[model samples]
Target chain A: MQNDIILEATGLTKEFLGFVAVKDVNLRVRRHSIHALIGPNGAGKTTCFNLLTHFLVPTSGRIRFNGVDITGRSPAAIARMGLVRSFQISAVFPHLTVRDNVRVALQRPLRNSFQFWRSDSMLDRLNDRALALIEAVGLAPYAGLPAVELPYGRKRALEIATTLALEPEMLLLDEPMAGLAHEDIDRIAQLIRKVAADRTVLMVEHNMSVVADLSDTITVLARGEKLAEGPYAEVSKHPQVIEAYVGTGHG
Target chain B: MSTRNVGFLLLAVALVAPWVAYPVFLMTALCFALFACAFNLLIGYAGLMSFGHAMFFGLAGYVCGHAIKVWGWPPELAMLGGALAAGALGVVTGALAIRRQGIYFAMITLAFSQMVYFFCLQAPFTGGEDGLQGIPRSPMLGGLLPVHNDMVLYYVVLAIFLFGFGAIYRIIHSPFGQVLKAIRENEQRAVSLGYNADRYKLVAFILSATLAGLAGSLKAVVMQFATLTDVTAAMSGEVVLMALVGGIGTIFGPVVGAVIIITMQNYLAATGEWVLVIQGVIFVAIVLAFRKGIVGEIADRWRAYSAGSRK
Candidate 1:
């Protein structure tokens, strides 16, 4: 069972100018499970996500992916190791067309991203896959449009499509439904479920119903500390979890 | 018109330019145009505003001049040597400059260029304030074609410009160029997608510096002199202005910009200090009235019109 743990963090802590943002937190994500990290605002969900992806270094901790230490690896390095993250702000290349944005991501795994001498037509081979990913994210209609012109929901879809192009083994989605309307939330939730079919997924989401529906395992945080960990059926009924959510006005 | 047709039309115009205009003047404009195009690769495509690109242009001119005058290297070899030197300098400067981004990157490049300027000012080989003068235009292909004549030199300069410009065009349309654009649009997004944005930027810087060096080397041969004015900070500002006026992100924007600015300089030569004031006014007007630059504005309007027609 221990070998089944794909990504493990032990005693993760982050301090900013003598103020602790995340403190002595441990997290274990099992192979092919959808894990959710949910909490009220300023509960250090984003900070914890950054630490795992190496956007922010943990003050003291060890992170292991596939049983190898990646505590100090860069975001790019960790991403290359198949732990890709989507930004909370919908990190799509705004100036690029939807097809081009996906193609850029697909180019990374080909290891020819530095080959400046070759024509971009060489990457036309990726068009089929890129188009498929775009369609999967329901952005086929906007494939030719620059990402900047995409509606907010479609832009998030494009971001997911680009991230999917990386073929990551585990994905970290930071607030994947942030700022989404009800219909968009449903669509994106479905997209996330479809993508998680063959990979582990770790997410920080504020939407409780989405988290309840999608997460296979849930970890609740409060003020940078882990408050509860279990399935939604068990964790939702915990007294402290109820008190924390209600007290923090998250209810 | 199709993009390919537009490109062919531009190429045809360039082919006939030297015949219609003064060959020497046309060659000089082409040289500056190539220089501006090289500068555009960094600022326009890669989103790096190097405030000291003159270091590459000026230093390469000095090196090419030295190679021609002292070492008596062939014209091709001399220009190659100069471009290589500039590429080497780019590696050093880019490594340091890419450590910081945005305004800091610009400042670092500017500081490095200033240092090179002072070095050129005092260096024995650079001829101090007098510059490297009387550089001979050697014959090409082992004396198969003499380049002392302005007509013959124009062809040579034209060939070199086309090669450099074609290479830049190829680079911008490559998969690597796609990644560069992605980096420009969202560096963090590029990084998360497993790209080392700094490394990409450094490669772009080297390519740009090498091409700028090629332009400078050609300019030295055309004019038969490498002067301190080539290396000055003002030259850097001029390239920026050219890119801005033409359209920083457009393929032919810098070339158009170089043509306009160089033509203005030629026409306003008698106006002395007024040339600088007029350039300032043009810059202000372009920034306020046509923020997308001349070519960019035209491109936008063309797209809008075409879209409307489709409807």
Candidate 2:
């Protein structure tokens, strides 16, 4: 079980000035599992997620990924190591076409991003792969359209496609279904499950149904501390988890 | 029209402009046009608004003027020296300026450029108030062709302009350009995708400064003098105006903007301070009526028309 863990966090804590946003918490995500971090608003889930991705420095913690200590690494360095993250807000380059947005991500691992002298036509070689990613995200029809013009749901899909272009070993999605309509939520939930088949996914989400359907392991948090952790069937019935959710007025 | 057709048309117009227009005036416009185009590279594509670009432009002019006047270096070497000097300055300034974004970045650049301006005002080699005078246009092609003739010098400036402009066009269409645009549109997203956004911005800054230097060197050779005006903050504002009026992001926009502005300056020489008022009015009008700029607005309209026609 220890060897199966791809990402492990020990005693992770974050504080804003004097107020603690996330208390000492330990999280271990096994390889190829869809792990969900669910909490009501102000539950410190986003803070924990930000700390893990190094967007915010952990007040005190040790983060190990694939057996290497990764706490204090820059976000780009962490991403380069295949621990890519997606923003809660859809993060696509608005001026670039959907295909170009994915291509920009694809260029990162190739290490040819500084080749300014080469014609962009040289990037045409990535078109087949880029289009495949677009199709996978159900954005093939909008491949050539500027991402700024994309509808809200489609923009989120493009963000996922861009993140997937990195081909990460572990993916951290921050509220992957935030602002999504009901129909779009179902599509994205299905998309997330399909992508999770080959990779580890740790997500912070408020939508419990999506969590129950996709998460193999569920961790519940409230007021900056973990409340419960188990398979969804077991964790959903935990009295403390129910009380925390209900107490927060989210029941 | 297709981009290829536009390219051909521009090339044809450039080739024939010298015969129809005053060669000296045309050369002056070409030099400024290159300067504005280089300025546009940073502000338009990289989303960096550098307020001290004239430091590169004026400093390169001083370097090229000194090399030609005192060292008697060949014309091409002098220009290359100026460009390389400006590129090195870019690396130093860009490293500092890129640490801040938006208005702070602009302020830092402005401060650094002002320092350069003061240095130029007091530096012994720069001739202070008198400026570097009578910079000779030396012979080219191993002394086979002399640049003493205005027409010959015009061709040289035109060739340099085309080369510099073409280089910028190529960069904007390259994979590297795509990443810069990504950084411009959403820097945080670009970083999440593993791009070192600051490094890319620095490279772009250096490239823009190098090209600006190239234009400045050409201007020094053409005018046969490097003056304090070249390094002034006003020069920086002028380049920005050209880029904005022509179209901030469009390929040929700055060139068009430069020509219009330069021609206005030439014709309105007798208007004295009214010229400033006219320029301000034009800027205000551009901001209010067509914020995309002349070429940008035209391009947008063309796209809309084409889309409608297809429908």
Candidate 3:
């Protein structure tokens, strides 16, 4: 496999009040590869994701995305540059219809989303594309239903569908399989694989089996630092990595 | 009945309302209705609530009253000037207030409007407590009807109200409006989707403020006077009350809300100090019984019934 780094973070650290949530972590996400960040509870997995996505300002660090320095950039600007992050919790627009939720994600491409004079019927042009996205996520049956009305697993699908609608070059999935049931997990794993086919994915997942199955490289974070990094087979066998998980009585 | 059909029925009532009822009273309700609707656009659809909305409403009244009295400008031009003035103010205040969220945002707007209220008090053109009086009502469509006729003035105010209402309706149904709803639902998710949520918010703020200014200008022209009452903090609360009584997010809720509230105040004048106590009781009763406001409750029931019938 061609190993070109698509996203690189150097010495990323974040301090909240006086507490250091994330400390001196360097990460390299490969081009068109699945990179997983996993750790037990209180390991700063979500904080690290926020720092990389510029949602949280780092106390000290540098981040280069596709070779461009993106530190201190606005979240919206980072997203426009094709680095999109999904929330760890289900974050679909609850009151909007499933199709309308997808359509909102499509709005970022337009130069202006502020034509207050025109009727929404003019947006029929986007209906086909929005419907296509909804179908891909297995949410076609619930297209007209309000997102809040969907079952939890279906809401996750809608959230991912909304994220995918942005057509990001690098997708950051924060615990994509965090709350899924057994059947839902398999479908999401399949969807993730399908989406990561032509794009890079960096995910923070706690599901060990999922981490083992889907990751090209697993970066094990323990107590705000990288404990080990490599293929899941090699990293899983690392002495300190094993000790960190076992000592903490983790899953 | 469909919302569209209900809308048509309301329109029919408004057309002949002046002939049957007191024209001035109907015109006053229409102005307040437009004001409440403009206020609703921010709080209802955009999830923004400004406690200082009277700043926009009052400033436009001052500007419109001044223009008619001093510049000798026609009615249309005065209203346009008033709306543009409010829009300009919106741009300045919205840019600053959107820096914070929730209560901070509300406080920022309230602070800005408090400053504006004091400015209007001391400003030479505002006439301070007396306000700008004798704002002449110009001929509708350049002498299309008698300028002195309350019916003609009624039609002009109605035209302005319809225009504002139509614009707001278009905004609420447009692609832009959908984005606002998205932001309202989850601002963080909206931002992550590459929307400069602040920009959308500022645009909505400006639009809402401009329509509110139009309402204020109409009130000045109708009453032939723009008083300090229009710009007071109490006026802001009154608009919010109207929205709550009608339904915060429903389109026609503001109109229904404004009419009911205004009618209560107007007809209850005989009781003097008891009017306030009576209005309070009635308001509490409506809020307690109809949590969604009248139209919102009615709309919800209608939706549930229709869905049940289909099943």
- Candidate with top lDDT is 1
Backbone atom clashes (below 3 Å) for every candidate: 0, 0, 0
Tell me the TM-score of each prediction against the true structure: 0.98, 0.97, 0.97
Q: Candidate 1's residue-wise lDDT over B52-132, tens digit each? A: 999999999999999999999998999999999999999999999999999999999999999999999999899999999
Task: Give the lowest summed-lDDT range of ten residues in model 1 chain A.
Answer: A242-251
lDDT of 1 at B40: 97
lDDT of 3 by residue, B211-235 (tens): 9999998888899898888888888
User: What is the DockQ for all candidates, taken in turn?
Assistant: 0.85, 0.84, 0.85
Worst 10 residues of 2 chain A by lDDT: A242-251
Kindly report which residue pairs in candidate 3 clash with one another. none
Q: What is the docking quality class of candidate 3?
A: high
TM-score of 3: 0.97
Error of 2 at B232 (Å): 1.6
Kindly report which residue pairs in candidate 2 clash with one another: none
Give residue B176's error in model 2 in angstroms: 0.9
Docking class of 1: high
